[model samples]
Target chain A: MKKSIDAKKGKGPKAKLSNDQLLTLYRNLVRADHFDKCYVRRIQAGQLISFYHAGEGGLAPGVGACSFLRKEDILWPHHRAHAQGHMLSKGIDLKYYLAEHTGKTTGCCKGRSSYHWSFPEYGVFGTSGCIGAGFSPTVGWGLACKKNGDGQITMMCCGDGGSNRGTAHESFLMANNWKLPIVYLIENNGLAIFSKHEDMHPTKDIADLAKGYGMPAVIVDGQDVIAVAEATLKAVEHARAGKGPYLIEAKTVRIQAHGVGLPDLVDYTPRSKEEIDELRERDAILICRERLLTEGLLSQELIDQIEAEATQEVADAERFADESPVADQLDLSDINKLVYAE
Target chain B: MREITLIEAIREAYIEEMQVDEKVFLVGQDIRGGNFPNTTGLVEMFGDDRVLDTPISETAMVGSAFGAAQMGYRPVVDFMSGGFAYVAACEVLLQSAQHYFQHGGNVSVPLVITAGVGAGLKLANEHSVTPHAMFLHHPGIKVAFPSTPYDAKGLMKSAIRDNNPVCMFWHLALMMEKGQVPEEEYLVPLGVADVKREGTDVTVVATGLQVKHALEVAANLESEVSVEVVDLRSMEPLDYEAISRSLEKTNRLVVVDEDTERCGFAAELIAQVVDKSFDLLDAPIERICIDNMPIPGGYLEAHVLPNPAKIETAIRRVIA
Candidate 1:
């Protein structure tokens, strides 16, 4: 019998309550929310340079899936990556990411790849802006994991739009053929930029595509952290048991506009203020807080403490970005340092 | 001591390297029977896993090789022709070339992309393009255009072992041309040049199949003019040492190429000479390249390629 890890009340493992572990989860989610809020504000203030609108609210599936894994498990995030990276604290470097946005020397890529080209050492091999491009590399990493005999599973987070790409299909085929340990999580946020899921596929569930590859698929309410975490935990367990790969279609809502750009100002088919207000009440972080408080697991004082710490953390990250030194090298010849010289 | 076709030399190199290192593998279309005979007898000798056949997707093939290289595998990808290189350009330029720099030196791409090129046999417009200039312009890539079987075998071995992405072009016209090669394993490093013939009157520089034509032209003009022939084995990071030395020894110069004259290899060579060593030349540099037009197949090829007679005429004009 596997040892049950003590988690929040009505969350993770059924029995139990350690204030520390529960606090860790609560703090992580709050930090993630703080990071996303900071990121959006920076983009709005012209502080974040590479502002690609992948839509708001698409960060839940990544956060939920990553919350269950150990530090060793690598993640490959698609375009909407700030929340995912923040969840793992691997991509929480505000200075480097801000520099990357501003096309500054202090950026992660040294100003070479601005918005779309991402590289976060925090276990993110990099985000694929090319729709389904992340799929192949994710499968390759999963294959590497199998060959190395490492129990680490790679989680690839993609959007509903990327599900229709050929690379996605190919990755599924290759992952199943090789029996790689990977969890393919599709954040089905209802729309692919402008086109809705109904306008794209006949079957409402994005997991239907996984059937063609002979891989097991599941669907869950992405807004519910407990549900999302449970589904991801099950998938991770399956992969850890060497049962091959699995897919999870996370149904979530992106309350914010795609990005902090022109879309925020212009109205395409403008939603009513009331509809937007109704969606705002379903904020994942707020829902988690309410659930914990309602179940007597968390107090108002604890929630306030978590929020304060998250605010301070975000403030420190901003200062680090402000003071970080810029990379001065002109020629990138030294970039081939580790590669074999022929 | 042994004679082999252009493809056979490459096959021998692949066999020699695979036997030496288990990390090397071949992936491409129809390589089982050696698609273009470049990988002949490899599948049988190495088995299917090592010399695996791939689907007709160039992007996947190149991207897979890039991924494989990152995972400690040295992949040798063979495209049938230079035109097909365009299909794999994204993986080559964007992914393979940029990863080393983008990953902050955390990864390396030890992959060699090989293709047959040039315009003499007139395989027609699509097949016969000498797309060397495009590759030469890109940074972080090594371009090898071998004119002889010996150079092909040696340079290919170097390319396979290279850490960065390397493109080796084997001319279709020089596929059957025989040259002396040592039986032992040896490698000609990238950005090196070979002197095909020595002379003191006019330095005629060429690449790929053009090396043979330039040598033939030099021989034909033995009495009238002493023509030195230089073969640029690698295109990018060109061996300017050999060009400068040839120019210093021979006052007049002529650059012969199978591709069109506009924005061709010759144009760059001339620019380099002007920038670095213009005073060493006695006369204006002459360029003997094919006219600006698509290569025509069949008998029309005779007029499309820079032949010995054309190179000879260009050399005479430079000396006059």
Candidate 2:
């Protein structure tokens, strides 16, 4: 059972990833999961200002993929940006995010975005609740990268439902027209909030939209960390090489309800019990751990250490959130200070 | 002081700002030749890197301007026409303006969204109609409607230097009008009103091209009545003081706006005057604005835009 994990790819030698780098990514995912869990608990305790509906799944995809990105790159996420924010913990202090959610002073965006999304310094621009609204701004960042001749590219994350928004189409057309270096990631987690992708979109393949715009598109198993990472690295490389825009459709599953308030009756209604169970079995974190263990890349001691450290980090973040200051109405004045002379 | 057309004044402002500040640049559709002639001579002066002539994508252009401003550059975006602002509304009103307060004072979006407002030429419905009311309703935005060449230069310079997002509406017809401007660097403060003329019998609150028309109507009727004319240079943080002062002096008020009558600047001004300066009123406030219909074509355009005849009628009614 203890085979070399180095033979991951078809190449004679698997590309080596530093242990520190792997640990950082794993740690970020744990933090993301902890933040979302705390968000659910706080909402249940009625301590939150706005209710975000991304509590369905555990940690896996959003945080997992985000952990692989460079800190300087721009990130545009949809309404379900919980894991994304958590994974970028280094870029965004968790206290600010919690404060924002709880309408507190220490919130990343104060309480202004309490009713909606946030924009931390982590290059994560505010999330678009309006389906595909994040595409154009992300494209703008990509254009900025091209203009500045910087190696940085923008990552636009949206759901299957957002793929149909006219703004998203316009964003792609313009992105191709100007050859803006960006990566469009579609999380086809079967549902766009309440509506299933089948009922929403006429075309089954969302990635095909990229080809019409003259951009390369890829479909990947989103639940598989290695698959998602490989696809992302390819897209990142393409953009870095000035190959213009690319799209990746990640087929994943939301193992829970759309958000915290989903009626228990609707659970597994759209999806078969067997399918749901199978998807859940393929949890991204579990898959990564199993792969590491089976390939002998990580020992039991190392795994235990990571889990314990991640748990401790989550506990610390939760304590920080609880002790954070609540936001006041006068704090709204802070938002206006920088608009003009202040 | 040298004389220049409204277009020339805006161009000079861009040129002067670009020459002085390394952070200032231009972005818009067809910005190379200065789309609509507002950027004329800019490409020759600042080069392509700064004066970016973008594709016909309002969202990209506006979004790019928003990003660039976030990156510490002052972007003077030419949205071309008022209608185009609707396309980039998400970026301007929602993201650009709202971000200042929404992001908890995290980002400074020093962007100037310039567009041609009101209809004088027969450009028909798609091109005409003043849509500034939409922006005025939103906080965190500075809206400027300059009537003359001088105000255009001064206000634009002020807009470029200001940290907040400033929406500048320049009437297309006034683009060719000439006015005196100071040669030295200067900034006309935001949220301030300019009293174009002094009077006592009645007050005329005007904005954009209507300010000119109101001034003309007041001049023609000078001997008969002393009409006070106040140009609402800034629409959002409206110079309530100036309007209130005028209302206190004249008692009779007539608000003239280039935009439509419903939910327009006139409505807001009248409401404020009635609320704060109720005791100063001699008669019920009147408004001179376009009919609540789409901007018409051919001969109807002259009929559609607020005219001196309409202002005169409103003034006479209030004073009578």
Candidate 3:
């Protein structure tokens, strides 16, 4: 049986991250929230056309966990904005992300892939449009890391819906058997678009599924960046020590509609206005801000300054995306060139 | 030259490729157990680290290979049989095939998916299939079907070295068939065709096991019909030029394939030939392909598959 460690209850030891690091984590949470809100505004204004999933409440898991990874360590992100926001926090240029969104030649993927941006130079190997597809490749990356004896761990993010895929289980078995240094981070936001965890899955806890594979599993409150960082630190340490793959299920809530305030968002998500408000009150950025203020790690003035800077950064990114050139019309001769490598 | 079977030739290519490139590794089901003769001793040679025996997870294995290839490793994934390609169709077609192009030609997937194909073994509906047509239809992937031991070694080497994803279908019936393979290293380029027999009366384009049958038919009709056999070693980068050149000499054509008659490789080949050099044709193109139906078990399997007699009949009909 797998032992379930919950960081929300503060059951385990506190995270060893310094006060400066904690402040940085809080700042990233604010930045991710701001970035998401900017994208939402852009979409509403018809300035940006995108499949936008708001990462309001789920910023901590993405931002905090990614902070522990090294430059060589790879991150296989999911299609959600939380993962993209994590990439942004990891210093992936805001211009590249915005440019890719606008289908510009200056995009990270050269306007080829819109949301599924891959910058291997920044250790962001790639993300897949298909659910559960990224798991296997992350395992492969882990295998490569193990063979090279590079001590570079691979962190793969998947939703609760994607975790139910056969590929995820297969990856778990393979990673476990080979003892590949990989962290299967399940961002259990309790919603698979419209379907809730209780409706879609049999087990109450997503981490419990790891028991059958005999892998170490943990459950953490994704709203708490410190808890997430602590859980992730444990998982990363276990993997780096060659103790095999570890599973961390960060239980959080999706604060907004699945994508861009679709007409079916309210019809599909049967949550009351009161319940939605209650969920919003537990938002990670809000919680982190409160915690930072209480612990004397950040002042209201500094927090306001950080928010202003982040808003300005988003404005700058929008300008960069607007100024970036779109890809030129392809010649018939060059049509087949992109199909195969030179 | 060394006399080796098709399976031996495949095994030798893996051995040589793995011996030279540390990045080259094998991953599949029962590879360590050596259930498939082609990958029999690879585990013993390379050990478990390199020759990984994966669980019965086709999607995971293929997807992992695609990922590893992106990470600068040449992964040779064995699906055990071509029938399993259906199970891994999404990963092969969507992930591996589309990765290079979808990334704006920025990434390369050096993945070789080796599977035993064709329907002569009577392995029932699930196991018996010649589905190279499905892969050949895709744009980014390079599909190869080697009929002879020599071509098998050379093509396998080239497929491993090539940057694109290559789906290599080894006909099950021809696995043990012996053919002369040069001891020195040689690569059969992906899009090239070899003329097994040259004649003026008719031209036959055949792939995989059908290539052997086409050659046999050409030899049997030596006195009756002067037949030219063009072995299409690679299916995707199809040697249409070679077929058109052969058609220049022999204006009649008989295309032989193990796949079904409807919308298959043979049909595609004929269409391309007609498009390129329709005026050169002295007669209508004849396609010797398997009847469009599920391959039955036992004796009926032989009847459904394309044979030398079928090739000869098609050749005679086209030439007449």
Candidate 4:
């Protein structure tokens, strides 16, 4: 039996975002798409050397999920797209963030972490290389919020691939048992690094795990920024109200290959030109752009301006990263001075 | 000074730390039930929220501590047994150790992780292994195994107060071992070694339960070889200087460790000592440790484990 509480079914609190909020969500989606494109361009042009999971088609879910979040709320980023959209939307400094990505000293981790990006000031503690490991620490963050008696809530996302780990179920049960303030977000791109969801998971909705824990869960159209944001806003309110955890499974698409510098293959075969085009048609950025144009919320002049500004911002960030110094490893002759904190 | 069991010393440390800081709390499986006796009555003192008892979830148990620690709360976690520490390997080994350095030292994971480790009492393959070597392999983690009640009380206090992730694995076999502990506060700092006995002929460096075996052998052989016994209470941030000073007096080195023999901590100690003081060695070094095999249950366990007999044999071999 299907046990998920559908956010679209009007059974729970539906988000009613203001016009300004809607436009803000649209702008965030556009910037997320732009940052991803910039990252891909640099990787393709050989200007940067780093591992990045290109999130071109999947940016909306993270951007929307983080749209209503405050700077005080913790966001444990999923490895998809290296969590750039979530980080940027949650307010990680763009120039330093890009610089860190480029291995420059001006980066957030002082270039110590090329990809495990963390800005605690912005409520993002570092992410783990192991996929499902994020669940437990995120619970800890939630536990802290509960213990502090502060209204701060923790939001974390895992790929459909990572959701199957025992950590996920354990964390969920523990969080519910303690009634910790957390929003468990699922970025269901339906592909766990080339394996489709149909073959990988049973029962389609991973949020069913939430139902098993006796927690409220929702499923939303991940490409639709407004929808994702609305679902997120309601879920965030549910958790912030001391109602325990809320699970949101955003059904998104990953149009690009898992990582850059890799051939685009889905199901062990190179994606056909028509299949690629069809996937592009479902691109969250393109979809959002078309919807805004149709709604007359954004004029062609405004869209052009946003794109041009995003392009310039990306170029300036690239230049800043390229000009910055590589992180220095020496500190008064002790090479591992940064390894331990005094 | 009054004598207390090793388990009582640990309970005292928890009671003292919790009384000292409001942020200090305990989290683990059946902790509220005081199922381990060390955590007995902790819930009555600190209440449910602080003395968090969770279902059998090892990774989340540690991870919750990690989160709470990051938020500036000090948490003390007990894994029940060292062998089960592997259940939360990613959380314990990767997240706790790496989060600080990877995040540019912006976070402080101040937590003490303890597990009842080492073979004895026929606990078999799953529950009867020591895990200090696994923690020592990781750079940022601090590993300690307190062999006495006094050291258990003091070292645990230091670990709880230290601003890093610390794995303080006490010997399950040493739980009832009694020793004098001061009523007043004191600390046995990490990275320091204690010379259990002084001698001039040979130096035996050991940790955990092996320290007791070495001391017994040192006393039993006093008539012949005047043996010096060095207790390394902590592995990471090890007190190599003390070992060097002991080697300076006693030219022969023999290590007795209860863990595996092949590619083990005993080998590591010998390699490091030999590298630093090749001229100090008047004879080849010897190691008394468990041969490479899973420790068997019942009487069969004694054959593979290091005992006073093994320590005496190794000391004699190194001296001759």
Best by DockQ: 4
Evaluate all candidate structures by whole-model CA lDDT and list the values in order: 0.73, 0.75, 0.83, 0.84
Residue A218 deviation, candidate 4, in Å? 0.5
Per-residue CA lDDT of model 1 for B227-314, tens digit only, reads: 8899989986579999999988897889987778888888988998999998998899999887888788888977867888888778
TM-score-based ranking, best first?
Answer: 4, 3, 2, 1
lDDT string, candidate 1, A1-342, tens digits: 111111221124432324554455566677777777777787777776656463345555666677657665667665664543433443345556656555666666666556533443345545434676767566556755665567878788887888887767767876786677899988887766656778887887878777677787777777766656667777787788788888888888766666556443213475567866776777777777777878787888888888898799778777776676555556647533433244
lDDT value, residue B189 of candidate 4: 96
* Winner by DockQ between candidate 4 and candidate 3: 4
List TM-score per model, in order.
0.85, 0.91, 0.96, 0.97
Worst 10 residues of 2 chain A by lDDT: A1-10
**The candidate that achieves the highest lDDT relative to the unseen native structure:** 4
In model 3, the clashing pairs are none
Candidate rank order under DockQ: 4, 3, 2, 1
Residue-level lDDT of model 3, residues A201-313, one tens digit each, is 99888887777888888888888887888888878888999888888888888777677775424437567778788988888877888888898888879988999988898
- Which stretches of model 2 miss by more than 4 angstroms? A1-16, A55-59, A84-86, A89-91, A115-120, A263-270, A331-341
Write the number of the candidate with greater lDDT, choosing between 1 and 2.
Answer: 2
Worst 10 residues of 4 chain B by lDDT: B131-140
Output the number of the TM-score-best candidate: 4
lDDT of 1: 0.73
The superposed Cα distance between candidate 3 and the true structure at residue B74, in angstroms, equals 1.1
Estimate, for each residue in A216-285, the C-alpha lDDT of model 2 and write its tens digit.
7777776665655666676777787888887878777777667677653233455567866886787777
